[model samples]
Target: MGAPLSAWPWENLGIFKYMLYGPFVGRVMYEIFYEEEKDWKFSWCLQLLILSAVRGLVYLFWNCYTNSLFLTRNRQILKQGVDFKQIDKEWDWDNFLILQTIFASMAYYMFPFLQNLPTWNSKGVIAALIFHVGISEPLYYWVHKKFHGDYLFTNYHSLHHSSPVPQSLTAGHGTVLEHMFLSLVIGIPILGASLMGYGSISMIYGYILIFDFLRSLGHCNVEFIPHNLFETFPFMRYIMYTPTYHTLHHTEKDCNFCLFMPLFDALGNTLSSKSWELHKSYSAGNDSRVPEFVFLAHIVDITSAMHGQCCLRTFASLPFRTRFFLIPFFPFAVIGVSAMWLWSKTFLFSFYYLRDRLHQTWVVPRCGFMYFLPFATEGINKHIEQAILTADKIGVKVISLAALNKNESLNGGGKLFVDKHPNLRVRVVHGNTLTAAVILDEIPKDATEVFLTGATSKLGRAIALYLCQKKVKVLMLTLSTERFEKVQKEAPLEYQSYLVQVTKYQAAQHCKTWIVGKWITPREQNWAPRGTHFHQFVVPPIFAFRRDCTYGDLAAMRLPKDVEGLGCCEYTMDRGVVHACHAGGIVHMLEGWTHHEVGAIDVDRIDVVWKAAMKHDLRPLSSGSTIKAN
Candidate 1:
C-alpha cells in the first residue's frame, strides 16, 4: 500500500513558489527604483543598511505598542513599573549597532563572494534556493542545539534568553558570538545561492530583506498570523514558521530548533507539546494572558506505577553498608529501569494552566517517588532544580516550592534556589506565609493552650512563637529536649511563660488542639488524644485517626464558600482546603510582591495575605478526589 497524497511533500511547493517568485519581484522592483546607480557596491551597501534600519525601527515600534496593549487588555499592573533595569542590563544597543555595522561593512568587502549570474531565470533561482534551504536546515539545527548546552548557554546564548517577553529589538540583542553565529546561518543560504550562479544582485538583496523581516516578526511578541490558514492549507505549516513557533523556542530551549521553516523540527521530533494549541490561541487573537507566576510541587505517591516504588522498596530492605555502596549506582540504575517504563510514565515535569475570576496561575508538578525517602536528598534537590529551570524557561515571574520541596531546599526558605540558580531571572518563594496564615486561621479561638508536634522544626517553631505571641499557651513537643529548651528561651521575656516545653509525646494529652507540623507515620498519630482537633501540615494526611478525632491538613485548608480556590495544590480535604504554601504564593503573586516567604513567616503579615486569599473564594478539593501535589 502507498501513502496518501496528503502525506507527500506538497508543502515544499509553497517554499518553492515563495523562494522563486519573491526574488523575481525584488529584482524587478530594484531595477525600477535604482537603475541610475552606477557603483553597484556602494549602492548595495547603502540599500542594505537603510532596509535593516527601517525594518528594525518598524518592528520595534510594533513590538512596544502590542506589549503595552497586551498588558492593558490583561489588566496586568506592573507594581515596579517597566523593568527598565532589566532592559538596560540585557540590551546593549550601542554594542549591537557597532557589531551590526562591522558585519555589514565586512559583507560589503566580501561582495566578490556573491557570483553575479549571466541571466535571471525562474527555474534556476528556485533550484538554487531549494538547495540553499536543504543545506542550511540541518546545519542550523545542530548549531542551535549546541547553543543550548550549559557552557554555551551560560557564556553566549543566555543573553538571547534574557528577554522572556521578547521585543523585536531583542532579535539583534545577543552576545558577539551569538550574533556571529546567526550571521553565518543567514549568510550561508544567500552565499550558496550566489555561488550557484543563479541569483542576481537584486535577487540576493531581496532574500536578505525577507530574512530580516521574518527574523523581526519571529521575535515581535505578538501573534499576527492567521490561525485558519494552517487549518485550511495544512501543508503551509510545515513550509512557513509563525511568530508563536519561534517564541516557544526562546521560552523553551528544548524544542522548535528550525529558523525559517518547521521541516527540520518535525523531522527531528523536537516540537513542543503546547506549540499547536498556543499557535491556535495566539492566532485567533484570544486573550492568552501569559503566566505571571508558577507553583512547583512533586506528586507524592508511594505505590504508583511510575514512582519507582519497587526500587524504593528494595533500597529500603538493603543493609546500611550495602545501601551506602549502591548509592553511587542509584542514578544509573534509575535511568536503566526508567527507560523500560518511559512509554507508560508521565513526563518528569507537567504544566497546568489555572485561573480564577481575579487571577491566573501556572502549576507545574515534578514526578518522582524519592521525595518521601529521607536519604534521597540529592535526588530530590536535583528534581527541584529541574522544575525551577523549567519554570524559568517558561517566563514564570515567581515559582513557589511546595511541601517536601521546601524541606529539602533548607526550608533557606527559597534562598537556596535563588543562590543556586543566580542566572534564573524568576524569583523563588516557599509560599510559607500563606501556609502559616491558613494554619493560624484554623486555630480554635477559645483554646488558650495548643500542642505543637515537631516544635524544633522550622514551621513548628514559627507556629509556636506565633501562638505564644498571641498569648495562647503553646505546648512545644519534640524529640530534642535541648532544642526545645533553646526555642523556649528564645521567646520574648513577656511571652516566655506562655511557652510550655515537652520532650515526650505523652505530654501532648494536656492540650485539646494538636498541630502536626511534619509528616507523621500511623504510629506517631496514635499519641494524640482521642477527641483532639488536629491540624496537619504535611500532605496525604495521616487518615487512620480515632473516630472521635476531627483532622485536617491546615496548610491545605481552603477558604469559605464565597472564596474561589485558584487551583494551588491538586488535592482537597474534607471542606475545600488547598495547600497553604501554594495559596500563599498565589496571594503574593496577585499582590505583585516578589517576597520569598519560606522560613521567614511573620505573625503580623498573616492577616494581610489571608484577606487577599479570601477574596478569591479559594475552596478545597472535593473529598476523596486525588490531586497530585501542585
Candidate 2:
C-alpha cells in the first residue's frame, strides 16, 4: 500500500515499463534518419536516455560487486541478506531517471531561456554547486524528516524504509511522489543555473551523474570509505555521507535524513551518535563471521553459469532453463568463463542461514564441459583442494562436494581430498549417501521390482544393494558382466537372486518402476510401460517423453521451515528446496557429525543419515514431479 498517486502507472508492467520511453526514442530515431536538421530538444532527450542507461550500468556494477562475498565480506554493514521483497520493491529503481528526462524535455519547451547550449560550462558547475548546497540540501533535509511522521510514514516513506539492508538500487526505490520531490531537488541546481544564463549540457550531466554516484555509494551496504580520511579532515564527514551513515538512517529511521550531506543533520540535531562509530567499526574490518557449512558446487554448463546469484537474480530464482532474454548475455557468459579460467579459483556463489548456522555455496569455477576435458582434471582437482584447505583454515566444520565435484571418475567421490589431508579437521562429504536415501524413499512401498540405469555407478550401487536386502528385485542395467557379478556377490547370499543383471533398456518394458541414474534418450524412454514412474538421480534430468508415465525430479528435499534468507533457488529446484546432496551436507553439519563422508557410500549409514535429515526437519518432496503425468 502507498499514498495516493505514489505508485507509478506501470508498476505492474515488470520490464515492459521501459516502454514509456518508446515514444521519445521513436521521435529521436525519426530525427536522426528522416530529418535533414535535428531538433536540439530531440538530441538532448536522446542524451538524457543514454545518460540514464550509463547510470543504470553504474548501479548494476555496484550491486554485483557488493553481492560478492569474496570481495565485500568484511566490509558488509548488514549481516541479514536481502529477500525477494527487497528485490521486488527495487525492480523499477530507474523510474525517477525516466521521469526526470521526460520533465526536463517538457521544461525545455516551456522555458524560453533553456534552448540549445554548448557542451561544457565551467561557471555553470559552480552555480549548480551553490544551488545544491544553499537550496537542495536544506529542502531535502526538512522534507525527508517530515516524511518520517506517522501518516506520511505509513502511506509514502515506509516503502523506502522497507529494505533494512539497502543495495545500490535502494537509492531509487520509493513512491512516485518521493521521486517527484527528488526531481525538484535535483532540478533546482540546473534550473537555477539556467536562469542565471550559466547552464550548459555538461553542467546537467556532471551534476546528475555525481548525484546518482553519491546515492549509490551511500546505499551500497559495503563500507569501503576509510575512516582515516575523516580523521585527517574531520569536516569531510559533514560534507559526505558513507554507506554506514545511510545504513543508520534505514535501521534507526529518525536520524541522518540529509540526502548526501550529514551537515544538515548536525544542524537539525538528528545525527545519530553511533553513525561514525558504526562506520569506523565496519570499515576497520570487524564483521568476519565464518560459515559452519559449505557446499562446493561447480558450474554445470555455459547457460547455467549465467544463473549465478550475483549475475541474474530473476533467472537464478527460477529453475534453470534456456531463455530468449539470455541471448544478449551470451557474450558475458563466455567472458565469465575466460575470466574464471584465467584467474581460476573457488569463489563464493550464494549463502543463507539455517538455525543460526551460516551455509555458503562456493563454485569450483569450471563448467561441466570443461570437467570432461582430459587436460582440465588437474586444474579442477587443484581448485577443489584449495577450497577444502581454505575451509579448513577458516574453521568451517563441514564441506560437501556437489554434482560433478564429487564425480567418481574425477576424485573418487571426494575420497582423494580426504586421503591427501589425513590430518584435516574439516569433514569432507560427498552427500551421496543421503542422495541414495532420497531416491530409495521416493519409491512406493508397494513396488516389488525396479529397473535401474547406471547400475554400476556409486549411487546406483548403493540403491541396488539396499533394495536387494528388502527382497525387492533389482534389474541392474549394465553391459559389464564382471561389474554386475561383483555387485551381486556383495549382496547377502540369500538376497543375491533379487539383483538381476539385464544389459538393455528393452528388458525394463515389463517393469513399472524405473530408477534412472544415467541420462536416457526419448528412444530409450519408450521402453517404460505406461504407468512406469522414473525416479532419477541423473544430472540434467531425463526428459519426460511419455504422457502416461510420471517423471520424478532429481533427488531433492525441501529445506527446513526455519531456514532464513534463502532468496534464490538452487539450480532447477524450487524455492526453499535443495538437492538431496546439499541437504545431506546440512544434515551432517546439524548433527555435529565428525566423520568424513566421502569415497564410497556406507550402506549402514544411508538409513542413519535419512533419519537424521528428517529429525532436523528436512523433508522428502511430497509430489516428486513439478508437473503431473496421467
Best by lDDT: 2
Write model 2 residue lDDT over 1-630, tens digit each, in one string.
546967887878888888988987887888888887766453866886888888787787777777777678778888767766667667678887778778888888888777776777799999999999999999999999889999888888898998868988888888888888999999999999989989998888889889888889999899999999999999999999999999999999999999998999999999999988888899998766999999998888888888876787656777787899899989999998788878877888788889999889899889898778889899899999999999999899999999999888899999999999999989999899999988888877767899999998999999999999887999999999999998899888999999999988999999999999989999999998898889999887888889999988888999988887676788888888999999999999999999999987998788899889888999888634321111
| Best-fitting candidate, scored by TM-score | 2
Please give the CA lDDT of all the candidate structures. 0.59, 0.87
Write the residue-wise lDDT of candidate 1 on 1-630 in tens digits.
222221112223532422323443464467657886654444554555555555555555544443433133222111111123334543343244444545655665677744334335454457546755877667788888898999887777776787655556667666667666666766666666666656565555566657667777777666778879989999888888877888888777789988878878889898787777788876666454445666665544312222221222212212212235455555655564455334322222112223432323322233345555667666556556766776678676777777667774433566677777668766787877666666766776667888887677767777787788778888887667688778887778899899887777778765668888766665666777778878777554667557777877456645445333211124333323446777777667767776556455665676677677766666433233211112
What TM value does model 1 have?
0.45
Cα shift from native, residue 116, model 1 (Å): 70
Q: Distance from true position, residue 487, model 2, in Å?
A: 1.2
Residue 607 local lDDT, model 2? 83
Residue 2 of model 2 has an lDDT of 48
Q: Which stretches of candidate 1 lie over 4 Å from their true place?
A: 1-289, 302-368, 372-376, 408-411, 421-425, 519-530, 557-569, 572-577, 619-630
Task: List where candidate 2 sits over 4 angstroms from the true fold.
Answer: 39-42, 623-630
